[model samples]
Target: MKKQLLLLVLLFLGSIALLQSQVTGTVTDEDGTPLPGASVVKKGTRVGTTTDFDGKFSIDAIIGDRLTISYIGYQPKEVLINSTIMSITLVSGVQLAEVVITGSRNPNRTATESTVPIDVIDVKQLANAAPQVNLNQILNYVAPSFTSNTQTISDGTDHIDPASLRGLGPDQVLVLINGKRRHTSSLINVNGTFGRGSVGTDLNAIPTAAIQRIEVLRDGAAAQYGSDAIAGVINIILNKNVDELLINVT
Candidate 1:
């Protein structure tokens, strides 16, 4: 009797595993053109895949699986799959509005509600502009008050000075990557004659292709981001949806 019971349990488990299915399909834009290198993720989970050159993709998931489809310059689409061979159509890209977070720690709050002034750069704008190499080239000249100085250094380290937010030193200005604080460069000094110094972000650490948007707050935010907030804050938001095997055709 014990041996028979064990066999029944094993068989039940095996059957359940087989019930889970795999889903696959090609992704395309509304114009019926193939969208290669598009991101296809299982909604809520990190499991995902990118479309190949032919805009073809395959992924493993069970029935009633929720999948998210996203591509740069295109609107994201989510679908619930109950069968095999699901073709997804993504819409034309929409221009996203500028979103800023100022007062308090709440992300839902906008710049209007806060005491500080936050500058928002939409991702669509950056993609359309097609910046080359470092993001510093663009961020420095684009914003009103911010200034970037590129100093050529020969000390074996890649030398690109940090950006100055309203002439404040680099150390005084806090830099956040993907909304998380990153370590400042230990090599250079951002402080100048002014109580604030000449510090800038090493844009090389971040790739323009991966950037989603950049937010610059032009007021004092010591209370929100802590001590480094003395000068101001620059937040670099990275895209979480891209899945391209980038091949730079030089």
Candidate 2:
């Protein structure tokens, strides 16, 4: 009886060893280039491995088990492990084109190619986070270096608040609307305010409803633009792709 029990135990161990098998695979892109660092994971389990420098990976898996292969910028692929070796070709994901014009002279230049730091705020972001309808107030909260203060009764300056960038005077910062030079407000801040003795642009003059996106170039562009861009340049791009006339009361 003891010998019979030993034989049954050996058969069970052999069956278990046969159930678990080693799986090897090579991951490649659509162009047939080896994609190193690709992840290969068994479905619904923690068993996984990554491709080596040659885009080859090996992991323990059973037959009929599913394997998921994934890589950055590529579409994920899944296959059933019918064999020990697998050759996977991952397709590329769809990429969207971006438009950037703040720091680059070329209109077709992307934001990643710009040497200067740039911040782009869309209309939705501006209006969603703004507590007040004033553009200066919205920029003060959104922009890093922009600042503005409300004047109670400081002549015409109360109506037209002055805004500064990078802790510099208001006149030091240049403002552009739709790529055109926007004129500064006639009211100069002569009172004791944040930007005293500086005439700044009346950003409130342009309704936030009309704006599409605001691009702020944080680097000095005196050589490219002019001396007016000593502090930085704030370019307000208007929406030209409006198919329907939408108006916001507030």
Candidate 3:
């Protein structure tokens, strides 16, 4: 009688183990688009697996086990494991506005840490609203303490308006393209409009469409970058992206 009782107990334990089977499922959005990297977890336990590139996931579970699926920007779902194959669709209920940031992230920076102020202008965003495609005119409207005045009567400064900063002459404000010093293409001459006619770069030479962004160091950069930056520094970063090509008409 003792041997028969032990045999019955072993057979009962084996039957319980055989009840559990493998469960597979595919996770998709409401529109049937596969949601790759979605989270899939078995309820009441830590066993879980993320959806593959094809949104397919597999796990070992019994017929009554529960599964929870979750994804970012979508409502989570829960379902009972009734079959070996399952199809889960996450609802599009949760949505938040996108925060667009152009500048680099600096968490611990304080306002008093640096004396010089820098103005960051996103040229790509300005391209749509600007009246003309002139880079010089766009800077005058967006950046503070900077101006590009067109001299209707001046000699060489006629077509190419000079750029100035902090009420200083164009020569006093150093211009840099991609961190390298950009020398003045020609002299202002006659001590006219923007300084003693020694050095001045042509702002009109750089195409506005090719520029990505501009960083203007407000004032007092001469101590670090020499007399060229006595008023400030204007760094023009051109677009080095390999995605698009630009064509001009006349």
By lDDT, the best candidate is: 2
- Considering TM-score, where higher is better, how would the candidates rank from best to worst? 2, 3, 1
Q: Relative to the true structure, how large is the alpha-carbon lDDT of every model?
A: 0.73, 0.84, 0.81
Ten residues in a row with the worst lDDT in model 1? Answer: 190-199
- Per residue, candidate 3 scores C-alpha lDDT tens digits across 129-167 of 766578788888877688887776777777767778988
> What's the CA RMSD of model 2 in angstroms?
13.5
Q: Scored by Cα lDDT, where does model 3 land?
A: 0.81
Candidate 1 at 229: error in angstroms? 1.2
For residues 72-178, what per-residue lDDT tens digits would candidate 2 score against the true structure?
Answer: 88888899988888899999975659756663333432255568767787766757667768788878877777887878778777788888788888888899998
lDDT by residue (1-250, candidate 1, tens digit) is 9999999999999877756667889999988899999999999899999999989999988778899999999988999987878889999967879868754333432355556667777644655565544677667645666766655442313465566677776667788988898776655443342223334456567777677778888777889889788878889888778776654331
Looking at model 2, report the run of 10 residues with the lowest lDDT sum. 103-112
Q: Note each model's CA RMSD in angstroms.
A: 21.2, 13.5, 14.5
Candidate 1 clash pair list = 162-200, 162-201, 163-200, 163-201, 169-197, 170-199, 190-197, 190-198, 191-197, 192-197
Answer with 1 or 3, whichever has the higher lDDT: 3
